[model samples]
Target: MWPFTKRPKDPVLDPSYGDPHRKALIRALEKRKWKFARELLNMAADPDEMAFLMEAVGGVDGIQDWIGDWMDAEPESTLPVLVAGCHAVRWAWEARGGKRAKYTTAAQFKGFHERLRHAEALLQRVLAREPDNVTARAWLVTSSRGLGVGPAEARQRFEAVTRLHPGHLVAHEQRLQYLCAKWSGSHEEMFDFARGAATAAGPNSLLHELVAVAHIEKWDATEREEGNEYIVSDEVRAELLTAAEDSIFHPDYVPAGPGWAPRVATFAMAFELADEFDAAGHAFALLDGLVTEWPWQILGDPVEKFTASRDWVTTNRS
Candidate 1:
């Protein structure tokens, strides 16, 4: 009797309906049921629903391609999907371990840098439309840093992110990195930043390494006992020595390229404080591996030789 005045479509048939299928797909994804979700999405009737389902199961590259197709079909659409795609790519990169991938050649680094730039540009465009988007702003800053943007530009972006969202942890960490690079030889500033970060972020291994590096740099430069004492607390020195020994045997922390230097330096500090022979031995072993793995042609023979020799001398002498 109310047919004419009734809603145009049955709620059950409405795409917004509980979408039992979508719910099931989301559940499967949450449970890490990749295979089931992938199968269901392939059979879903709605394109948008299928897109979301695919994204749930397929990971970053999949989402990027799916969203790219959607954009090609509907250029005037809002950017939620594209934004999600950018997030997926960023997550994928992070899951590979931030800035520590073992690249075979200079070309790979260039390619990675370009991909990071592309993601940053897309997020920037999104932020332009939505000025209050803190997540997009954060991603932009992180991507900019990943692309090796100079400290000044990265700091500006990080400062803007902090202004928009004061408690952003990643922005704070990135700022610390920028400070470290900017004041490379300044142990006081670097230690201050590292201590603040450790207090704020709570005993992160990376922050400990940063603090250790600052101390090691000072000690290496001045050959002073005060610098050595300042870098490694007695407790941390023991833990670091243990970690260095494990890393030497297992090499769980053999991050490639410039990444190795920080870990190596941290281990050296630990060895200095603990006077552990094996820890010192392992540090040089890993450094030697880095030299062998790194491309001397692109990275330069002089730099490689210097690093290799430096590691050898430090390990043997102390």
Candidate 2:
């Protein structure tokens, strides 16, 4: 049965789920107060926080149009340049639409490539001035795939960031997308990369969710019944349990900046699908009433699926 037939109050569907300061930055951008955005970016506590801030800025609609004002105002700062380049990548994908290649029109593909090229040029300029800009380097990793630079160049761009900050979550997540079977790699490659990264990352790191992400990708590709079977199988259940234990369940674990909510929500969904209601319930508990748009959006309405899953876990967990 479809779960969204009736609705309760909508869940908090915040994209910048874990970050309290994200709204102020977005408001500043909405008002074209670019200097305020620059101040927020400059004050970011670390690379992860900085990357998250840029990602939030990059996702705003029409940001590309007025971002140039910021670029003009701060000729010497790479901050606006990074924001422009990041938004260009997002805008390129918007041109491409969300459909597979077969469903996409040629003109859309042309616009996608053109925008990506513009993004690449801007990102390269930032790198030229600041070679150690791992945030710029990570966005470059994303654009490499869109530009069809192939696996070698993609890995090289990913390595450039990891060498500087080995645990850079955004960079690792982007590379994982590149490695997915739907993209450049096969299922074997995807799982291998996810498992290896999870193990290599330090204890309590959210990298363990990479394993859940891999399984979710595989689930998305398979037919419904078979996918359900695979996700609920004993092996998958055990692996997810192990991943939970190593990461979110670890006593030392603390949610990592803005990325934490989505990662937890991901594990919650995987657990519910795998029929490990207890684990799912715990994750939902961690989330309180908050929800993010992705992974659940893959199912249907993110809020509906999230609410249904959380409710189901509450009712069914032992």
Among all candidates shown, the one with the greatest lDDT: 2
Which candidate comes out best when scored by TM-score?
2
Tens-place lDDT per residue, model 2, 54-81, is 7788768888888888888889988889
**C-alpha positional error of residue 86 in candidate 1 after TM-score superposition, expressed in Å:** 3.6
Error of 2 at 272 (Å): 1.1
**What lDDT tens digits, residue by residue, belong to model 1 across residues 1-318?**
001222122111111113456557657555644446446655755322343343333232344544564455545643544444355545545444433335335665566566676676667666767776555566666566556676578767877876775545445544554455333215566568656654454432333454444444444444457645544566646645434334433434444321234345445434544455445554544444333212122224534543544444444553
Q: Candidate 1: minimum summed lDDT over ten consecutive residues — where?
A: 7-16
TM match of model 2 to true structure: 0.94
> Each model's C-alpha lDDT?
0.48, 0.86
TM-score of each: 0.42, 0.94
TM value for model 1 = 0.42
Reference-based lDDT, residue 150, model 2: 81
How many residue pairs of model 2 clash at the backbone? 0
